[model samples]
Target: MTCQLRVLGCSGGIGGDNRTTAFLLNQNILIDAGTGVADLQLHELRAIDHVFLTHAHLDHIACLPLLLDAVVGARTAPVYVHATEQTIQLLRSHIFNWLIWPDFTVIPSAERPSLIFVPHELGQVEQMGELSVTPLPAIHTVPAVSFLLSSKASSVVFSGDTIGGTDFWQVVNQVASLKALIIETAFADKEHAIADAAKHLCPSTLAKELKEWQGTAEVLITHLKPGESEVTIREVLELDHIHPIRRLLQGEIIEF
Candidate 1:
């Protein structure tokens, strides 16, 4: 079966139609439970069984607690939240500590809670039906990872909020069937300094990162700050050697 990925939200911030990062994999899995998750109807929200987080940043995890709260009573099984041990720990310490939000993992009863954290190490691959999700290295302010989603036919990589680094490309170049690369360029060229300070990518930094890329995957830029989307995309398009780059839009879907 061909796997499908739907962009639930991809903006760096929230305003008007803009939403934070979130992607729906097929119908049952979520790549990140950002504000975009709110766009899903109640029925669609209830169908999410697994969520793979890239990091613990609020923009990436903002809607997770709400999603669980909305669906806890509707589902029979716990919602599986997959992330690195560090990310999971941060969620446990900060987000789900019962003070900020109810700790759904132990809510109602510990014997059968509404949510479960599934810890995955870097480079580990988890099989979910026809999809293979592999955690890839990422450079960010906190413990983070990218994801390589592969089916039997093709694959795509989501570089979840990363800076320019060679570690991610090392694994990305090895993917024999890569079809697309969904990456972040959170700032415009003028904001390169802020991008560097925040460990995010601007157009210039993104160009530098692409130097290590060797695959034929179509490049789709994501996470552009809402107001500067056009400027960032224009800068990315003006990059000297990179070809066929496009801005990722909310509601877009990619099949593989």
Candidate 2:
């Protein structure tokens, strides 16, 4: 198995070359179908067999419909989409409800539909190909969860948009082989109130969160707002002594 991960995008918002969040794992499984998925070539799109979504937010799931539409009949099997049941409801009620897009789950017929929904729960672990995926706790405005992607060599936890909490760090500290912690710090100190109200992290809270972690995973910051990227990253840089934190860039490849 090819134990590799490619970061397609990690921006908080779009415009001027920024794409939202998406990650391709082993070229066959996508962690999130954000706008970044648009960068994949045709063949690459067809190769995706599974997509695990962290939540149903637009930036995180913007390309899911387009992706399903792109690979409808070209592949032999349905593309399984994993998410929490609440997220599934959001997608069904808002996105695939025929008004917005075709419900591919039963489109060509239920027997051979193009997309499948797999409802997951916190602490649930799924073995997809050679990797083990688990949902971890996260506190977001809407219900959301982080993910732990593990291969035999190492593990990487991706914290989808969230306000760091004790429950989040509790699960993270248990992963003995964690190689990297790909997290979100969407705002800077200047936007702390906005961040708090939105249930997102800024540099200040990120530091408090780090104090609860008990692992050696390299911290890779993600989801910085376009205009605040520099400020947010600089604030995060001040916490390097806590956990080797750095900014995660689009198109970067992380291998384990």
Candidate achieving the largest lDDT: 1
TM-score, structure 2 vs. true: 0.98
Q: How accurate is candidate 1 locally (lDDT)?
A: 0.93
Q: Which runs of model 2 end up more than 4 angstroms from their true locations?
A: none
Residue 172, candidate 1: C-alpha displacement in angstroms: 0.2
Residue 216 lDDT, candidate 1, scale 0-100: 67
Q: Ten-residue segment with the worst summed lDDT in candidate 1?
A: 236-245
Candidate 2 all-Cα RMSD: 1.0
How far out, in Å, is residue 17 in model 1?
0.3
Number of colliding residue pairs in model 2: 0
User: Over the stretch 139-161, how does candidate 1's per-residue lDDT look in tens digits?
Assistant: 99999999999999999999999
